[model samples]
Target chain A: MKYSILASTLLLAGGVAVLSGCSQVQEPAGICNMSAIAAQRQLAAAPSRVQGGESPLLEMPLNSVSITDYSVINKLYVRTVNARRTPTGTVEVYAQIINCTDFPLNAEARTQFYDAGQAPSEPISAWKRFNLPARTSNTYQTQSIGTQSAAFYMVELRETK
Target chain B: MRRARALPLLVLASAFSLSACQTVQNTAGTPTQYLDPGSSGVVRGVGIEGQDIRSMSDEMMRDLLTVPALANASISPNVIVDAEYFQNESSSRINKNIITDRLRVDLNRASRGRMQFVGRQYADMVQSERNLNQAGVVSGGTIARTAGQLAGDYRLGGRITSIDARDPRSGMIERTHQITFEMVNLQNGQIIWSNYYDLRKAAQDDIIYR
Candidate 1:
């Protein structure tokens, strides 16, 4: 009887170990604490939310400038971004980009506007190209064209491709 | 000796036949991809492109909205946008309708009743329907018929011009395109609003724009 009980106990232990291993694999270790790169990818991969849909877990701040190309990050940076409504109620965004490198640089940028609820308000703006002299600042300006109120905006920049 | 010669000929024929039976690579061609119309597409040239048309029209549309006499007027002014007066003097071959059509459509949607657009291009069709209604061939519409078609207060007219330079030795070409957009007061013939877009591009060779 003791030998039989020992065998039964060993089998149970083996089964428990296999189940626990699976549980560990499926436990979602980094879900609550995602790295910055992973979080960025998640935010970009997620589709734009509808008007009343659930908000994204990660979102870039409103009226912010994002340098999407890492290669351009060290070469240039946005100095200031100003967004305000024009007299006609359209949202206008202006940004100043400063080139840090000693050589002249060409960069492109586009803007996406959002409504008060953080839903995209208008079609994204066309990519505007600008040339920056060495160690100089260049201004970039764009406005949203829609009847919908544009309460927020984000600008993305990359090296001219 | 004849059997030996026949064996050699058969071997040579078999070698040729075997070479003919070789397998081909059978590679696949590139799949089609959708690109944003507002961004630079894969095919580019030293002339005005689709992105240029979109960007320029968008910019002008926003500018037109900011004018007090147009968008925020007490009574929305009737505006007619068509390719009738818009001219293209550039070397690049582009359908002029592409620019005017986009501008009118986008402006009409964004205006949202703040401005009115007259269907001047469909005047003949509208006139035919009106004649039918009057002749009793078709029943009168539920709404009351007006005595005359709507008249436009403002009309859009523009011109596209370009300058081209070519290098003799390097075979390089440079092109500069200047497109001007203007809204004219139909009654006074005064240009109430005007804007222009300019771009310069240099390239060695480019794909044909069709």
Candidate 2:
């Protein structure tokens, strides 16, 4: 009888110990919080204003010479070309224009070639304007304007005000 | 005598086992923390903290520019916005009406618009209209029409949403919240512009205790 009781008690104690050990082992792992970083990102992504007044030109009326329904003649284009004689052979020029506000633009704006002193040189009427409707956009080829001339050249909007 | 002694021993063992079970149950249960009203700089969760009308409005105003659609368009003249619909989500503790008020202020500032509050007289008008409809005295559609007549060109409407979840294995908690604002052209029922802002926060469960 004593041996039987001893054996049963030993078995119960061993089972209890095993269960307790398992429970301890199953305890949840620690967690690392990342809430702060998320909050920071949100704050950074938020749109914010830098201090400045509105542009003055936005309030002014757009100048128009004629009310003829015009299309956008040409969109802006820029390119570089090589000068034959000069060591600094490369020159760059940008050209573009809106054809008409009303009709679709047909011809691309031409690069009216000019000399160093703003005089007409090569009439590369080779540039053609394209049709662009009102409130629309168009693109044209970039021309190398002052490649060979040793004199400096500049491009400007030519339509008379 | 031997049998009697073994019975007492078995009872004691059973008692020990029962106590151990109770301890495990108590330890495994979830624990919660409450906000201390007196605590300072304890950043409240999205909707728990009292609404900061001024700050919220300012933030909303600034975000208006970030909308890609508006970037290239000509800037609009500032207009005034009155509160349309501002309420807290069901789960939030914050007062939703206060949020709406703040939004009005914020949008006004951001868009350079003004805000005009509907006074007590208008409130009475709305209440009377509600009562009339409830009593079957007037058509429900008339209420909106009457309100619009009193109000102006645009109506601002918005909603807020939020989610909170905790991961048991990682002991990580994440909270996400968003607000969407829309401007409706009342006459045409067209949505002229809409903006949305989302905020997310995550912290380890342990840090929550800290």
Candidate 3:
């Protein structure tokens, strides 16, 4: 009777130990360390060709980098890009960010402007912050002072903890 | 004697088991790390912050770039920007120059000679230099000699005003700020380009705005 009781108690303890490990499985999802960067290239206006031709946007690239947070993937993304070169030979760009989350998020972003030679342009923009309300988005607009030198650009977003 | 030895061993075994339980259960303390302000600055009660300054100036720069008066073939219009016109009529006691300086410096860099800025704040130094040059104490470099100080084509001016209301029960303070920026054409005395940025902040009196 003693051996039987001890065996049953040991089995009960083993079962409790197995059940306790399940909570750890859920925690491995862990805290979100996810962020995304979007890049856009400014194309010269095609004055001769009709506007209905191949969109300059198709030539522009949408790059996703260092994505780890799957939970917030649908929560935010680059909506569109509008870019133009000024008569003064400088470039102006507007990057729209959309937030699909149900809560407000303070998103931060920075941009790198590059020359035609693929060399980084001077005075790379500092990281700028934006406040996004739930289910809404906003445009972050900036420009390259060296419009003649700027041929490419990249916009980066980071998990602003 | 045997009972005493057994008791010590039992206590040591219990200690090891308890430590194992603690190791398994102590996963709650996730540590925090510091982040750069340019990347992720700390946020306080909804107030004007470094992030706000960056975003505000960036938006203003973009808008100015769109307006021909500031960014087109208008080869560098001489302009004046100062805190006197960019007043803080809001409850927040922020330095008004912070806004104007950022806008001016960033625009100057990004405008690519499309916009020129004059420092009315340093008129004294300019007058001193011109006076010395006129007196022949110091020779003036030849560009195009002018009779007097160069006049600005447009004067960048605006006001930062606010409206404050209180929640009766919670006593929480909700403050709204309307920051307006305009570039007035000096010749015609008309506001050529004008826009306003708005922000609303609410919190208790204990919060600091800086």
Clashing pairs in 1: none
- Measured against the true structure, the TM-scores of the candidates, in listed sequence, are 0.78, 0.32, 0.64
- Name the lDDT value of residue B63 in candidate 1: 80
Instruction: Tell me what TM-score chain B of candidate 2 gets against the true chain B.
Output: 0.48
lDDT of each residue in A1-161, candidate 2, tens digit only = 99999999999999999989888853232221235422322111211233454333221111111112222112211222222222123233333333323343333233344456435544332222234455344443323322343243323222211
User: Model 2 in CAPRI terms: which quality?
Assistant: incorrect
Cα lDDT tens digits, model 2, B86-126, are: 44463445555565665554444333222333333266777
Q: Candidate 2 — what's its lDDT?
A: 0.44
Q: Candidate 3 local accuracy as lDDT? A: 0.70
Q: Mind giving the per-residue lDDT tens digits that candidate 1 earns over A1-161?
A: 99999999999999999989888854321122224433443233233467557656554466877888878866776668998777677878999988876688888888998888878888887788788888788998888875447888989988876
What DockQ do you compute for every candidate structure? Answer: 0.33, 0.01, 0.22
Stretches > 4 Å off in candidate 2: A1-161, B1-40, B46-55, B63-84, B106-121, B125-149, B169-171, B204-210
For each candidate, report what fraction of the true interface contacts it reproduces.
0.51, 0.00, 0.37
Best by DockQ: 1
- Point out the worst 10-residue segment of candidate 1 chain B by lDDT: B201-210
Q: What does the lDDT read for residue A87 in candidate 3?
A: 53
Q: Compared with the true structure, what per-residue lDDT tens digits does model 3 show for residues B1-210?
A: 999989989999999998887645546686686655444254566567676677678677766877766777536688887776676777777988889999988888777677788888888998998888889898857766578887888888888888888888888988888889998888998998888887776777556655
Write the residue-wise lDDT of candidate 3 on A56-113 in tens digits.
4322232212222444544676667667886555676677777765578766666677
